[model samples]
Each structure stands twice: as C-alpha cells, then as structure tokens.
Target chain A: MTLRLNLLIVLFLSFSALSFAQNNEIPAVDVKKIDGTTFNTGDIENDGKPIIINFWATWCSPCKRELNNIAEMYEEWVEETGVKLIALSIDDARNMGKVAPYVNGKGWEYEVYIDPNGDFKRALGVNNVPHTFLVDGNGKIVWQHNSYSEGDEYELFELVKKLSEGESID
Target chain B: MKNYSLLTSAASILLAFTLTFIGGELKAQQGIDDVLNNGEIRGNFQLEAQYYQEDSLIGAQDVPEKILSNGFLNLIYTNGSFSMGVRYESYLNALLGFPEGYRGNGVTYRFASFTQEKMSVTVGNFYEQFGNGLIFRTYEERGLGYDNMMDGVRVKFKPAPGLSLTGITGKQRLFFEYGEGIVRGLDAEFYLNDGISALANSKTQIILGASGISKYQPDQDSRYVLPENVGAVAGRVNITHGFFNVNAEYAWKANDPSADNGYIYRPGEALFVQASYSRKGFGLVLAAKRNDNMSFRSDRTEGQQNLLINYLPALTKQHTYNLLATLYPYAVQLNGEVAFQADLIYKFDKGSVLGGKYGMDVQFNVATANNIDTTMLNDERTTRQGYTSDWFKRGELYFQDINTQITKKFSKKVKGRFTYANLIYNQDVIEGKPGVPVIRANVGIADVTYKFNMRNSLRTEVQFLLTEQDQGDWATAIFEYSYAPHWFFAIMDQYNYGNEDPERQIHYYNASMGYNNGGNRITLSYGRQRAGIFCVGGVCRVVPASSGLYLSLTSSF
Candidate 1:
C-alpha cells in the first residue's frame, strides 16, 4: 500500500514538472495573410496591422458557428478597426468540395484559404477546429481561443480593438 | 554495447536526414529528378514513453513494473504509380500492460501497384474497414494505442461506376508480429442508383454488399477437436426511400469455442437491424441486434484482438463532455447479447417560447442488452456443426438505459443544458470479474453559461450520479471563466459519497488554465483523474485513479 501511494506521488510530481516545463507564455506567431499572391511574412508584420487567423473545417459545426458569427459582424469590425480576418479551411479533398458552396451560401466577408493538408494548422499547433489566433500588427500572436459559443464574437472584437491600438493585454 | 547500437542507428538516421536535405538543396540548385531516377528515400520516425501504475480494486492491476519505450520508423520510395515502404518497430522494456513478445523490431514491407484506369494492387500492411466494420476491419487507433494490421495483399477492381470488388488474404496483427492464423476474404458492393434505369426512376437509392472471411488456425488440444477452419458470411443492404433510411445485415459463423463456454464448441450467429428517419433539424434512429458466441477469431485459443474475425459496433452515443464522459464507458460482449438502441434529436426554431432567443435542441437515447439463452448439449456429440443451441431466446436483460437531454440558448449572452440518464449495467460481463454487483445508476446534469458583456464569460456545470452497486454514488461540480481571446480558467470537483470502499470515498478536484496565441494553445491543469473504463472495439481496460498535474501540448506544421 505504501509503495503504491509513493508511486502515485512520484507520478504526480513528474507531471507537475512537465507542466512547469511547458512554456505557456510565448510571443505570438507572425504570419502573412494568404491571397493567392504576396507571400511575405515580414512585410505584413511591419505594417502594424491586427490579423485574425481562424482554423476551421467544412464539416465541423463549431467552425461553422464561429465563422457565421464573425461574418455577421465582419463589416462592423473592419469599419471600427482596420483588422483583417483570414479563415483557413482544413478540409481534406473528401470534404473540400463543400467549402466553396458553404462559404458562398454564408456570404462571409473574410478572406478564405485552403490548408487541405493541415500544413498551417500543424505549424500553429492547432489540435482542434474553430481555433482562433489573434496576431498583432507586429505579426506576433497575442491571443488564441478554441471552440466558440453564441457570444464569443463580442470578446473577439474587444481584443481586435485592443491589439490594433498596440496594447499589451491578456 | 547498447549505447554502441544506439549510436550506430542514430548516425545512420542523421546521415539519411542530411542527405535528404542536401539532395533537396542540390535539386534546387541544379535540376530535379536526379535523385528520383536513382530512387528517392524518405523516412519518418516516432518514439513514445509511457508510465503505468496498477489499480487492484478493479482487477486492473497485476502488471509487471517497467519503463516502456517504443518507436517506429518508416522508409518509403515512390516512382510513377509504383511505391514501396518498409516499417521497423521496436519496444524496449515493454510493460506488462502491453502484450508479450514486442521487444525486437524488424522490417515490415509494403509494395503497391496502382493505376488511375482500372485496378490497384497492394501487398503489405494495410487497413480496411468493411461496411461500418462488421465482418472485417484492420485499422489503428494511436491514442488508445491499438493496431490490428493485416499482413496480406489486397486487390481492388473498379471496372465501372457503382460496382467495386475487393479481395484480401493475410493474418491479423499480434504484438510486434502476426497472429497464428490465416484469413481470406472477398467483398463486393453494388450501388443500384448509379448507371441503372430501374432504380433511378423514383429518388430511390440502394446499396447491396456481401462479404465472407474464412479463418484457419491449427488445433493442438487433444481433448477436443477444435474446428481448424471457421468461416463467417455477412450480407448487408441499405435502402433509402424518400426521407427514411433502412439498413440491415446478417452474419453467421461456423462452430468454434474456447474458455468462454467451457470449451463447448458452438456455431454462433448474429443479426443486426437498423432504421433511421431524418429530414432537417430532427432525426430518429432505431436498431435491434442479436448475437451468440459470434466471437470469430483467427485463433480461438487467444483472446483480445488475437484473431478477430468480426467487429461488433457500440450502440451508445460517443459523448465528449468531460463530466458526462468520465463516469461510465459502455463495453460490448460477444458471447451472447440481444440488444436494441434508439436515438431522437429535435431542434426548435428561434424566437419561440421553447427556443427562447436562439434555438432549443433536445435529444433522447435508450439502449438495452441481454444474454442469449442456451441449452445443454449432449457430451457425446462431435464433428460437423459442433454444439446445438436455440437461435433467439429472450433471456434475462443484462443492461438497460434511458437518457434525455435539452439545450437552449436564452439569448446571445446565455445558454444552458439539462440532461438526465437512468442506466442498468451488468457487472458480470462488463467488468469480467465475478462478485461485482449489477449497477443501477441515475445521473443528472445541468450546465449554464452567462457572458459578462462582450469579452468575458462564466460557465458552471453540476452533476449528480446515484448508484447502489459497486462504487456507489458520485457528485461533480465544475466552473469555468473565459476572458475572450487570450485566457480561460476552470475549477472542478468530484465527490464520491457512496463508495463501498472507504479508501475510495474521497473528493477529487482539479484547476486548469489555458492560453491561446496564433496556432498554438497551452493548457495547464492540476487534478485527480479518476480511473475509469477505457475501451476500444468491444474490449475494455480499467484505468486507475490518480492525483496528478497533466500538461499536453500539440502542434502541427
């Protein structure tokens, strides 16, 4: 009994050490917006612009909800703060055929790109869909969120405003 | 000596990596296809380390102590439509939790010849799942850490639209090697709605499929004449009429037995019937199943996934919510089971009384399973079909459950859900350990969320589970706070109030925080993860409860 208890304690300590070793606070990733042209990350970051990068899928319900929510407020968001939102669809070829139709049906204003092989998502370490990354004008990632609810868009806009003003906040 | 081997292998891998880099650079400088004509070499390696602790109360202990290390390396070369790959796997100090004889690594090869025109042939380790995976399925689930690779060759012929044929011959995977049996199978599927005239007249769609798998395992026991070769045949048809869909499949296996029925060889049979109705936001499904000693295997003597000939699918909703999922995981029994399940989901329109502001979603599910009745066979019978038994006797119900859930969004800032489930679980077949009482469980859960303005929100969940058998009663409470884009925090506690063991009657609590930036999100949590049933396929392994802080970081590039 004592041995089992001690083993549990050791496992706990090791896991705690692993948790501490994980760096939770790191500077945001700097990335350029995809437009079928102009693939320069440094120039995009130096322009002091806020970038909203959302990793999504065509079949994932939460991704649909997040994109629809942002679409409903995309006009207001752009007018309020000159922020650019980019939606990356990670749908493979099996489901990629639905992406164009789905986006057209929703009438989203954000730029859309395909990460069919999930190259960009892996680079960003995204494990789940509907993961959003907030990158500041300096192209450094400032904030991120996974999943979405009804009112999550409101919170997103607040961060966009703050980041556009060059404020360091969490 | 061990270090020397490691150094040699490491040097080889480094040399390969450097060569690949230099090859790519040189190709960029000069022209392409220089290395490709010589044969391109591409490889990838993966390593894993695991720590296992035993839990004795649930009969999940008895594993030998060891630090487990396993890795796999795959090297592939592709030219034109022909490709070849070799995979090597090694496990040093494999823990008792894993199967035996998985210590050494060797090369496993794959050669595939394919064309865009008519046919594709593959000779190597391959994964295939037939029709929802009933009669045959070979696949890998890395997280739960299970793989049933097929060491065989397969051919797929697609001469025309709506018709396809596949045939395979191989053996199932056994720890670091192959099972001691051979399997041969053939499957053909035909779609009635495509390239046909009779079925295309009325929006009617039909799919007909037939599959057969024969397993051969040599018998060694002198006391009983075990059928060295057993065969199972399954046929399924799916017909869709308007908005209603119906699918049915029937499978039968020749007589074969082992330790389950006292080695009384009994030819088993199973039948599955399912139907669903769906239009828009509302869907309903009903299914009934009956199975008897239908545990087809490559080797009847070895249990687990040794020589699985058929796969039985789970009939429960695969839950994702943390609190709802951790309590009980359903396990399927192949010896004998007569079961049925039903699911209904309806979504209410927005701006209604029930829908409030956004919409309301309600779901209900119920499932039940029972043992099949059997008659005593004369001890003198031998040869042919083995033991005789009744096909469909309504035996005692081994398990039953009913669940109902409701979700509604009152406004853009608030949403909530209410769920309740009543379950009856048989411990004998599920836990596999005798003397554990059957469990009658009643579970209730409520989750509510309220957003504070735009950038902040708070969500809370409370759950109560009452049971009189086994571990008794439990109650859980959870709270989460999200600060919009960047940060979120959660606190949760689960209390066992009716534990039969006094030492197990304790409260487990956890606190967690998460920060997401760009494509990376970091979550940190400290808490006690209650040991519970972890199941893949129809088999389950109980995980022991432990207090620990866990961190997981995943990235893709």
Candidate 2:
C-alpha cells in the first residue's frame, strides 16, 4: 500500500506545476466529410459563434444516447445560442460504413464527419468516446468533458448559453 | 554497462521533456490574454493498478508482485501545420494477462510530421491503414497489449483534387524492438465524382482505391527453400446513390508459409462487401465477407496476435451489456470463414400508438459465420499449394447471434430500454478445443433511468443469461446514481445460478465511484473479475480471473 501511494504521489507532483488553461487553439488535423472531401478541423468557421464538437461511434450506446438527447433540443439550442454542433465519428473501417446510416436514421441535423484512421482522435488526446469540446469564436478550446449520463445535455447547454452571451463560464 | 547506458539516456529524455513542458506553461501563464502562436504543448496521462488474490478452482494464481501497475504519458507539440509527439510507457511487473515482455519502463513511441501544400511527410513512428485494412494496417490498442507501429518514413502526395498517393517503408515494432523484416507499401485513392464531370452534382458518386504491400525476410531454413519476398495486393470501390450505398474490397496474397498455418505455402484471399439504405427514421444494412489463409505477418515464426500487417474485424455487433459481452464473446476465425450480418433501426413518430407521448425506437441485428468449404489436395503434403476452397461453398456453422432491442421514453424525465439476444458459439472450432459441445445462450436486459432534478439522476439495469453449456446460467444487476458534471457511483453483482457445483456458484460483485472535472477522471473499484475475453472493435484481450482492488486515473491538458 505504501509503495503504491508513493508512486501516486510522485506522479502527482511531477504534473502539479500546472493545471490546463482551456484557452488553447484546437489541434489542426485532416478529417473527412460525408462528401468524401477532407478539411482541417481548425478551419471550421461559425461566424464567431460557439461550436460544440462531439466525438462518437456507431457502436457506443452511451455516445448514441447523448447525441440523441442533444439532437432532441439541438434546434432550440441553435436558435437560442447560435451554436453549431459538429459530430465526428471515430469509427474505423470495421464499422465506418455504418456511421452515415446510423446518424441519418437518428434524424440528427448536425454536420457529421469521419476520422477513419483516428488521426484527429489521437491529435486531440481523447482516451474514450462521447468526448466533447466547446470552442470559442476564436477557435480556442474553452472547455471539454468525457462520458455522459442522463440530463448531461442541460449542463452543456448552460455553458453554450454563457459563451453566446459573452460571459465567462468558469 | 549497456543496460545502464540505455536507462540513463531514457531518463535524460524524460527529464528534458518535463522541463520543456514546464517552461512552456510558465510563459503562457505570464499573460492571461497572450496567445502563443509559435508553439503549443498538449498531453494525456493514464495509470492503472490492481491487487490480486489466488483462487485454485478458477485458475487464478498468486502474483509475485502483489501490486502491478501500468502507466503511460503522451506529450505532443503542435505549431500550425507541423506537429511532433512522444509516448512514455511503463509496466512495473505488469498486470495479470498483459505481455510479460513489457515488464519495465521506457519511451516506446516518437514521431515528427510536417505538411506543406498538398504534400505531407512523416519521419519516425506512425500508424496508418488502407481501405478497410484488408491488406495493410499499423495501429495500437493499449488494453490488448497490441502495438504494431512502423518505424521509418511515410509520404503522401495529392497532386489533384480527387487523387491521392501514399508510400511508406519501415519495420514494424515487436514489443520493445523492431521486427526482423522490412515492409514496404503503396496506396492510391481516386474519387470519380470529382475527377469525372458527368458524375459531379449527380445523385450517384463513386470512389476507387488500391494498395500493395511486400515484406522481405532472409531465408534461414536449410531443408526447404523459403520465399524471401512476399506480396499482398488489394482493390476496393465505393458507390453511393440517393439513400443507398455499396462498398466492397478484394485482397490476394502470394504463396507464403508460416508457423500459424503449419508452414503450408497456401496463397491467401479475402473479400468483404456491405450495402445500406438509410433515411429519416429508418435504416437497414447488410454485410458479407470471406477470409482464407489471410494471416500475413512480418515474421514467419511468430504466433498468437502480434506483428500483423492487416486486420479482419468480425462482421458482428459489438455488444455492450455485461452479460451479453462476457458470457460468450466471439473472436474472428482467421484461418478460413464465411460471415454475414444485417442490422435494422427504425423510430416511430411521437404521439402515435406505439410511440406514446414521447417516441419509440426499435433495432434488430443478426449475424452468422460458417467454415469455408475446402478440400485437401493429393499432393498437399509437399506441394507449393496446400489446398483449394470452393468459391461459393460454405461448410458448417461457426457462430450466430440474433438480437432485438427497444427504447422508449415514458415521460420528460423517465426513459427505459429492453433487449433480448440469442447466440450460438462454437468453442470447438474458434477456441481450438475439439470435442467440446457447442454453447448456446439467451440473454435479456432491462435498463431504466429517472431524473430527480436537472443535476441528479438514478439508473438501474437488470440482466439475465441462461446457457446449458460452459458455466451455466447467470444473473446480473447494476445500480448507478450520478450528479451531473461531477460525481457518480455504481454497484453491480453477477450471480451464477445454474452451476452444477453449488460451491462454485459464486457472486462476482463490485462497487465503484468516480469523480470528473473538466477532462480529468479518477475511478476506484474493488471486486472479483471472472476470466473472459474483453474486446474493443472486434479485437480481444484476455482478462485473467482475479479478486482485488483496482484504481484508474486519466487526465488530459
């Protein structure tokens, strides 16, 4: 027990010098669109509105639930806050072909793309699915989270509302 | 002296990385509003440890190291279109079921990349895949102790809007070192919709791709002359019209002999196809595939799942429920198999009879795999070609799964889902244990959630599985409660009800709690885990049987 504690403490101290400042530019990487064209993720321009990027897959049940929940209120959220949601599928070739059909069947109106090779997922250092990022008007990632439960969408909408109103979320 | 030198060099590199990251952080902290367009540093860290106990009946043994830990830190630096990254990994004695070779710690991965105009180049280590990974793929899955990254140079050129060419030459990584063979590959993809004016702006679009790979290894056998150079080639096409799409790929390999195939010089072949039609509130998909002697690896003597140059994902649904996942999981039979899968998803309109006040969603999926019919040749013992397989013939059933699920929202704050599955698993063929009777299982699950308020929720899941073979029937239940954006707790228990031996009918119980705060999470659990195959994306890893406490942490910045 003592040895494990010591290792934990040492690991903690090594990274104690800094906490993440969420004000960093998004990693620039190539992700493909539904039309089979590639574009840089950092080039996404939403006319100074906030953009919510969600990393999901066709097989993950929790990811689908979260997307469906958000999709239920996406139209209202966009109308109220002018936010744009971009759903990025990290599905490899095994299930990459199912991504489009799955999303369309869910009746989601968000812009969807495929990270067929996990390039963007790796660049962003995402460890799991249902990872979400909130970017400000200047393309700086302002907040992020992983995983989701029921009623998590309201928390995200609150943050989007704050950003749209030009107020600090933290 | 050599070991000491390697350790010192590795320590110095890690220290240097820490210093550089600290300096970058200090500069950015100096001015809150100052943006550093010159460079930026980002990274993530994960640590997992477990304590084990022995159970003779379950086959779990005592750990020499009572506590084993696995950890890694990934650091990446990016500037405009240029980027570089390194990964440091450590396994202190390694956890149970992981590769014993990874018993120490070091920097295991490094790479640098730059892109200019329509061309890009990467030097050092990189991961890549080609057209469904039928012919070539390099990747990593930490939980499975699998990493086959390439160590060399890769370049990509896109001279035109619809055409792309990629070339790579390198040696694959085997554990802590490089494989003994050299691998080279080239791939090209062209989008006909963009290249041909007639297809542009039409309802139909077409894309075509091709890949070729070769590995060169020195011949060491004195009795039989081994082929020094082996080649594999693949071609693929994708076509899409309004509300419908079709994708297919075919791959072929030269005569190659290896340990996994009893050293038979049989050429390999693989074919995969998928079609789907989807629109609002409705979707359907069908898939078919066949693989024959398609195990291509860099080293001829290697066995098990290591140093593979291609991937063959099972054309079956990746289950999520614990009982459905752990009870009778399926792994791809690489030698030869024919598989088919179909899935359907539909949602009923709100306020309708079945839709209720909210809405109802239904999904159905079925998958089956069978052995490919083949006949042994009279001269197969010493001939170059081992056997011949009939193109359209299937021998015997290998596996099958029929699953149906329904989801409905009862109210604004209440939702429920129900699922049922029936499976047929052939342990004799897939698990290589002949004479063992086939295992058939049926599973049912119900999950419900209720929201007490905007920030709090409670969820419950009940699952039951019945099987006549293997360990018998089992029942599982889970209770979870969460406070949005902060904390959650869960408790679960799985009971073996139908075991013949009453003493062995045990409850695998566990309790866990986690805290989350903006890209960071820590979870602690104590429980008994049964031995089973834990898989992600169809690739599986064995999780040994053990009873212990586990701790995990993940954070990114």
Candidate 3:
C-alpha cells in the first residue's frame, strides 16, 4: 500500500511540474447571463485589455464591501487602464432571484453573470467568495487574491495598471 | 494488497493514456507544442487544524485527540473539449462538529468529462441540480461537511440554442461509501425568447423548466409494507419584462414512509414563488413558500441532513451582523411550514437630502414563518396515514424578524453603517427544545470604518442584543486593522451580561490575524467559542462550544 501511494504521489508531482511550466488560461465552463442566457467562460474577453473576474454572492458581506468600494473608483480605473470587470454571483436557486435586483440597486456598472450551480467557481478553484483574478491581455491568468480587506481593491487596481501597461507583475 | 494493486493499475492506465495522447498529438499536428500550450492545469488546497483545551465552565469537553485537522486538495486538468479532475481529502479523526464518517485519507472524488458542441457527458462523480433544486440536487457544502454527490453517468444535450435536456442515474455518496438506494432523474429547460424566432424581439422573456426524479430501494421491513420506488416531479417558470421579474416552482412527491415524517405515508408537496422589480438605485423583492411533509430522502431510516433529495429554501434575509446572524437564527421546518419575506433597497443619490456628499444606501427587510394547519387522523397504525392539512391556513408562528440598515459615507475618510432588528423566536419549535418559552429580542449594531491611507484602514463594530429569555441580553464589540494586500488583525469580545445565573455570565473573547498573498492565505486564532446552531441556506448543524487554538491555510493556482 505504501509503495502504491508513493507511486501516485510521484506521478502527480511530475504532472504538476510539467503543467506549471506552461501558461495557464481560463477553463471553459458554462454560466448564466443576467438575462438567463447561457454564457461560456472561455468566451470572456475585453478586446486584448486586462479583465478582472470577481466571485461574489448576495449573502456575503465582505463581497459586498469589496464591490461597493470598487464601484466608487471603477470609472477612473477604466479610463486609466481600459479594464473591464466581470462580476460572477455564486448565489444558488434560493437567492438567485435577488442577485440582479441587488446589483442594480448598488448601481454597479460591471458586467454581471450568475453561476447558480458554481460551475465556473469550481473550475477556477475558488474556495471562497470575494476571490479576485486578474487575466492579462493574452488571456493568461496573471494574479489572484483570496478574501478582501478595506484597501484590497487598491492592490488589485495596481496589478491591473501594470498588466495594461504591458509590464510584468509577480 | 488487493486494494493497492487495483489502485496501482488504475493509476498506471491513466498515466499511459495521457502519454499516448501526448504522442498522438505530437505526431498528428504540431510537435510537443500543442501538448504543452493547449492543456491547462489548476487546483486548490485547504487545511484547518485546531488544538483543544478542556473548559467545563463553557461545556467544552475533553478531547481524547488533543489536536484534530481536516485537509483537502483538488486537481483538474483540461485540454480543449476534454477535462478530468480528482479531490483528495483527509480528516485525521475528523474535526470536532464534523461528521464522524469522514475519517482517514483518500481520493473521495474523481471524474472525467467531455463536451463537443451541444452535448456533454460525465462518467464518474458529478454534482447536479434541477430547477430551484425542489426535487433533486446533489452538491457539496464544505463548511457543513455535507456532500451528496452522485457516482454514475450523466448526459446533457442542447438540441437547440435555448433548449437543454439532461438525464442522470446514480447513487448518492454516503461519506466514504455509496447509499443503498439508486436515483434517476430527467430535466428539460426552454428559453422561449431564444428558442422561438417569433419571440426573438419580444420585450418579455420567459423560461420554462421541468424535472422528474425517482429513487429505488428494496423494502426489507417485516412489519410494514413500504414503498419500493418513490418518485417526485417539479416544474418552474421564470418571466421577466423590463424591470419586473417573477419566478415560481412547484413540486409533488409520492407517499413514501420515512423517519423524518414519523413513518407516516403522506404525499409531500411544496411551492415557492418570488417576484421582484428593480431599476438603478431601487429594488424590491417579495417571496413566499409553503411546504407540507416535503422532507424527501433516499433512505427511509437516515436522518440529520443525510440522503436529502431536495432543498427547502429559507424565505428570509441571510443576516450578516454577528448578533443578528448567530442569535435566534431560523432553520427551515422540513416537515411543514409556510414562510414569506419582503425586501426593499434604495440608494439616495449624492447631493440629495439623505445622500449628502456621498450617497446613502438603505435596506429594509421583513420575514416570517409559521406552521401549517393540520388535523390528526384516527388511524393509529393500520393505515399509517398521518393527517390532513389546510393548504392556505396559517398555524402558530415559528419565527419572525423585521430589520433595516443604512450605509453612508460620513466624510472622505470615514464610512459607517447602522442596523436594527426585531425578532420573535419560538424556541420550543425552532430549536426542538420542549418547555422553552417564546423569546423576543431587539438588536442594534453600529459599524464604522476609518481610512488612514490607500493601503491602511481601521474598522470597529459595536452590537447589543436585548432579550428576556434564553441567554438573556448580550453585548459584543470588535476591532480590526488592515494593511492592504498583506496583513489584517482583529479582536472581539462577547459578554452575556444579562444572564440570570451570575456564574454563567461569561465573556467570550478571541483574537486573530491573517496574511494574504496572491491565491494564498494563512490565519491563526485562539478563542472561546459559544455553542449555537450554525446554518447555511436553512440547513443547520449544532456547533458545540469549545476553547481552542486554530490554524487555517488555503491556496489556489
């Protein structure tokens, strides 16, 4: 048993190493538009500009706080970096009916989608809400953040600025 | 040795298949480039460990295993139209408050799937849900240690642009093993505006969905004749026009004697309806639900959130405030209940009277749940028929809450929120505590934040709960400081000041800090926890009080 376990671990490590050497792009998963139409995550794009994907839910307080703070400076961010924000709500059927109304009441201008079944969320390996991902112009995921603090949006904006300028960010 | 050999062969076969695919791609198309460039791999990991200390005062018992931990890792690989994944989970003796069945380490979940144009198929483990999840839903809630995933075959076909059909047959996962009953389901959905060209330019949009699910389990009881096959069906409709939207679903289940309903052969039914209207800056939603013996489970004897085949949505606002959320939290009455909720949100524009320099957001919500009226039948044991219920009649109130909140920016560097709630909790019913009186409470909270710079901030919260029963009245205060992109620290104390027993009046104090980097986070805390019912989406579990040191780490790539 131990030998078999060791073999499995070694095989997994090797595969991980090989995959890590290549660029990671977004996975294809189906999500729902606010209008109830199916939308594929692979088709998400912003004309070669940087794209920000934020996983949020109507019941999550930290997610609401993060989105509300970003809404205050979203226009400025777009003007400076030409970036687009995609807000994905992981609300299940119980609260899905409230998502559009909740987003509209907040007056947020970001493109919104619904992942009622959490397909896109699981595909992206998001364990919690308020998880943010920054995808570069070439559609390669560059940076990601878990959880949210008061000023985390500023750090996210900084990355967006760097990516828009074609500068490498680590 | 037999299990080891089987697993070894499976791994070897998978490795060989991958290598063969790589070789084939290299020979048929570009050399080695397609294999590396077209495939993507991603996964996540999480670990939580806690060290326990015996504190009899708070009802925390001694832990034989002084330290316990839970860990999970998920890995997925995708190439073009094909993808596969596996999850490894370990619970060293299982954590406190978690299901005991989750012991040892193993690969609990694995699946391979492929999609080509309009059809997709999954042949291993999968999660699925029908409309509103009224009749069938297989999912995982890691926080609750609840996972009822299906292990079988599923196929989805989208014959048209706006129409989708799905079929599934499987057995539910019962911890490390599979349930005895087999489940089969079929679902279909149609988007009228997109499916029919005549409605392509229509202002109103409509979506229709229907599903039917059945479970098969052999009857083995000698004293009673039990159902061998039980089936349920549900239908849903969603309509949207301009700023108005309405959605509703109704489900019916055939009679199947189970432990949840006391082995009474009663047909189950449920109805859920929601309507909303919203534009920029203002929104309103109204929802109502009715359930009658709607506790559908695959096993006749299993209980406590196991083998559940449907979800009963709690028609109430999911409160976030500490005092409002934890104290007197309501759980759905699976046996029978009627509930209603109303919510309104409006934002006063900047420069307006209530808006001032910065706009003010106001939210008001009210929700209530009551038992369904039922009359007992005379048949004691011969027929097993339970009772007849009045469809629209309301019985005793189980729970009620009215709450409101206002958020505003006081100045350039200051923002604050104020909230108040009035709650009526029927402890005897909601908590299953016999002889307990109905408790009424009032709660108020003030949360404020001060921004020092673009990268630094401080936040504080003061909350108070006034009640005359149970824990009496309580007060809590919290403070947190954050240096963005990296570090955050928080401390909190909750005092049961108004407890009738002086010796039981204790203060629960805790402090924690965390560091967050891209896709990685680690946190450590030491605290005294209070015993309470923790719930997510109406499903709940009792969390015992404990004093402990806790650590958590999570990362994704």
Best candidate (score: TM-score): 3
For each candidate, what TM-score against the reference? 0.70, 0.92, 0.96
Candidate 2, residue B41: the lDDT equals: 61
How well is each residue in A82-169 modelled by candidate 2, as lDDT tens digits? 9999999988777877777787777789999998777888888887788898987777788889888777889899999999888877
Q: Please, what are the lDDT tens digits per residue for candidate 3 over residues B1-557? A: 65465456545544444445455544522423343455666889999999999999889999999999999988776767767788888899777888888898887888878787889998789998998898998888877788888999999999997899999999898888888999999999999998999999999999999999999999998877899999999999889899999999999999988888988888999999999999999989999999999998878889887888788888888887777888788888989999999999999999999999999999999999999999989675767789999987988999999999999999989999999999999999988899999999999999999999988999999999999999899999999999997999999999999999998999999999999898999999999888877766555677888999999999987
lDDT of 1 by residue, B1-557 (tens): 66344434433333343345445555321222222233333334445544444444333344354345565655444333343455566667653345555666655434443333457677777766555456777655432446676888988776667677789999887766688889899888777766477666767678788988888889898888777887888898777776566777788777776655457656677787777766556667787887777777677777765556566765654443444455665666778778788877776766777766676777788888887776555664554333455655667667787988887767777778788988787777676778777878898988888888776888888998898877789999989888766678999988887899888777778898877544345667776667675543234555566444445443321
List per-candidate RMSD values in Å: 11.4, 5.5, 2.7
DockQ of each two-chain model: 0.08, 0.33, 0.56
In Å, candidate 2's interface RMSD is 6.0
**lDDT score, candidate 2, position B125:** 91
lDDT of 1 by residue, A1-170 (tens): 66344334433443344323322221221121221111213233325678888888754655765786677578988888889887877654223323443454344667766664333443354556787878777666667766665467877888899987878766
Residue B345 of model 3, lDDT score: 92
Best by DockQ: 3
Candidate 3 TM-score to native: 0.96
CA lDDT of B497 in candidate 2? 81
